[model samples]
Target: MPKIQKRKIIIAKLIVILILLTIFAFSCDSKKPSSRGIRISETKTYEASLYRQNCAVCHGAEAYGKEVDGKQVPSLRFGEIEKKTDQEIYEQIAFGKNLMPSFKGQLTDEDIWRLVRFIRRDLQGKQQ
Candidate 1:
């Protein structure tokens, strides 16, 4: 091959390789930082919005609890919540307890379960 033609082919190959490398680097960059990492799934995001709109008023923003009608609403972050099984939490939310009102008709069973999971996992930091 002519020297100039040979040089042109080499440069083209190098450019192609660089382009591939750039693509690979960007593909591997998908991992987010650990601190900012955990993405709330669509379900969890919906559940969170549900909690905030419906439950957060009494449970407080973080389920830290708030007062209602001279009564102190219990915090889901506390020891009592930890002791409660998922079923119990689900029932409480569905049927209501103390000042808490029933959500049975308003919220579906699945949504109640989502809230239970949110409380246990997100608020209480429990794995399950």
Candidate 2:
């Protein structure tokens, strides 16, 4: 084949590789800053909306914790919980810790992660 054909093939392969890496990175359970940057989308007003629909009931409208069934869930709106490691938070969400129920069946991993992101960056310490 001609030199141009080889270059085109190489470029196509590179594009495909990048796309695959993006998918893999997000799907990875161990994603970290070095491995994969968790992208908090600029279009996250929708995410805050989701939080209201799904999490606000228990975590409170502002994620400042809520009382359900006489149990008080901690405020996820910042404070210590806001800065906890993702693994710790994920584990709590996956397996009901204390009064908070596990959201494993109710939400997809992405949805849970988005809620986490909203609490961490938006609601947490944010002045509305």
Candidate 3:
């Protein structure tokens, strides 16, 4: 190979390495765990917004379930969440209960999980 070509190839490789290193460092640096120790930054924000928009109306805006369609959905604030597994809550939300419609199509798994965490955190034991 020509000397200049070799130099160019080496430079390109160096640039790629630098980029990868920067990405790794940035990710590792910001990866400290949150209060729940989940090590996820979006969990809190995404969950809060999701709850506000999708759950607030029927859940009393605090995950304290409200009377809707003549049926009362149970409260969801704090330790009340401890009673159900994340999967269980996910199922209920995604599939819906009676008059409620499923949200599986409207939301992604990540968004649902974030909302689950929020339910467990903010309203689980708030009124109890």
lDDT top scorer: 1
Writing each residue's lDDT as its tens digit, candidate 2 over 101-123 gives 88899888888887666666665
Model 3 scores a C-alpha lDDT of 0.68
All candidates' TM-scores?
0.64, 0.55, 0.54
Which ranges in model 1 have alpha carbons more than 4 Å from their true place? 1-44
Q: Whole-model Cα lDDT per candidate?
A: 0.77, 0.68, 0.68
Where does candidate 1 have its weakest 10-residue lDDT segment? Answer: 33-42
Task: Output the worst ten-in-a-row residue range by lDDT, candidate 2.
Answer: 33-42
Query: Which one is best on TM-score?
Result: 1
Ranking by TM-score: 1, 2, 3
Query: Which residue segments of model 3 deviate by more than 4 Å?
Result: 1-44, 78-81, 125-128
Clashing pairs in 3: 77-123, 77-124, 77-125, 78-123, 78-124, 78-125
Model 1 per-residue lDDT at 48: 82
Question: Of 1 and 2, which scores higher on lDDT?
Answer: 1
